[model samples]
Target: MIGLEVSGGIWKATINRPEKANSLTAAMLTELAEIAERAGHEGARALVLTGAGRVFSAGADLEEAHAGLATNPVWERLSGAIAALPCLTIAALNGTVAGGAMGMVLACDLRVMVAGGKVFYPVMKLGFLPQPSDVPRLRSLVGPSRAAMILMAGQKITAEEAMSWGLIDRVVDAEALPDTVHALAADSVGASPAHATAIKRMIWA
Candidate 1:
């Protein structure tokens, strides 16, 4: 399941299947694109992507991924939707993020992780390589050495480590994540809208 909330200038997109660690089904992915598209015109200055349960996302629905119809193009469409979002895109990584889940975080402009949460990249294990389209962002975030480790070794890095390595902007107590993201969004709104948009455009460009 996927959920969307637009309130107080903060547009939140959440993964709603805590029972399944917020895994992404095909329907969920389609909803993600729709939510993002809707947020585009909602006068939202900041967008927060989060999860309903302990885990941010366990990654793509494994069953869906294995079904062979979850084609690369579908993933690209979702990725494009996220990448094209105009407002500040913030990821509140509440827990373990893996595989395609990691891609969602990478698509965002900023990411905040819970102190003990983790991130994993396992594309190689599944006999595939990193998406060429996503490689640039991943490389810029962690540099070649760390990106190689994630892509080649499929290692899982703790949230604390992620902060230190610059993979995530901040690490907060698990319970504090929502408030932290709220504060961040509010801070964005506190800035000049013109300047904020300009800065965001420059950063994204």
Candidate 2:
């Protein structure tokens, strides 16, 4: 499930199904894409994507994934929506991030992760490849060598390692994650929305 709320010039989208480690289902991915689109149309100055509990997301729900179906198209659309948002986008990684969920994280303009959290892409081990859109995004964040290491070598990166590798911008205590993200969002409130949007467009252009 996905939960969306807008306040203080920020649109927050939370992955609320903690019971299953917030694994994304087809319906949830659709909701996320819609939320991202709505946030842009609603004039949000910033967007934050995060999970409700200790795990950011375990990636696509295996059940749905194995049922002669593919959610990659929807997932790609969601990632594209986040990347194409005119406003700033931040991924608040309150917990572990794994598998296809890494695409969404990389699509964000910035990322703040909880200390001790882990990030891994298991596509290699699972006998698949990262989505076409995801490969370049990940490569851009950490460079080709490191990206290969993550994608081909199946390395599991820690929060500290992720920051060092340029996969995330900040790592904070779990308890401070929300406050830190809120502070970052609040600090951006003073910027001219037009200027911010322009800069974002140019950066991603």
Candidate 3:
């Protein structure tokens, strides 16, 4: 399930599926789009993407992945909306983030990964390649060499290493992650909404 919580000017969308490591199903992706649209139009200044389990997200459920690619197309549409969100989008990586989950992280303007967690985008293992637009974002976050290693070599980096590689803006203990993210989101909202929106549009463009 996907859940939305609006508090203190932050719109947080959480992936709730602890039993399945928060792996996203098709429905959840659609719900994400709906939440993003509503929050964007509602004039939210910040957004936090997270999960309600030990793992942030394991990416697409393997059984549903092919159908998602062919029939549903939820992944593309929802992720695109996230990337184009008018506000500052923060990814609070409380736990493991992998596979298709990496796309969502890349969509965010900033990412914070918890200690001991890991993140890897292994689209090559699925016999596919990431879309062209994702390439630049990944490069901007981690530089071309590390991005190439992730996509081409499929290297899975620990959160500490990911922080060192610049994939994540900060690394913190799991217990402290939420508060830290909330504080960051609050700071983002302190800026003029118009300026933030313009900057977001330009950066994503």
Which residue window of length 10 is worst by lDDT in model 1? 68-77
Give the TM-scores of the predictions, in the order they appear: 0.93, 0.95, 0.91
Quick one: best lDDT, which candidate? 2
Superior by lDDT: candidate 1 or candidate 2: 2
Write candidate 1's Cα lDDT for 132-185 as tens digits. 566777889889999878888888888888787889999999889999898887
- Look at candidate 1 and tell me the lDDT of residue 123: 84
Specify the poorest-scoring 10-residue window by lDDT in model 2.
Answer: 64-73
lDDT for each of the candidates?
0.81, 0.88, 0.83
Best by TM-score: 2
TM-score sort, best first: 2, 1, 3
Output the worst ten-in-a-row residue range by lDDT, candidate 3.
Answer: 67-76
Give one digit per residue, the lDDT tens place, for model 3 in 4-54.
899877999999998999987877888987887787888888889999878
Residue 13, model 1, lDDT: 88
lDDT for each residue of candidate 2 in 1-205, tens digit (9 for 90 to 100): 7888888899999999999999988889889999999888888888999999999999888888776224458888989999888888999999999988888898998899998899998888887668778899998889999998889999999999999999989999999998999888875666988989877778878
Q: In candidate 3, which residue pairs clash?
A: none
Give candidate 1's TM-score. Answer: 0.93
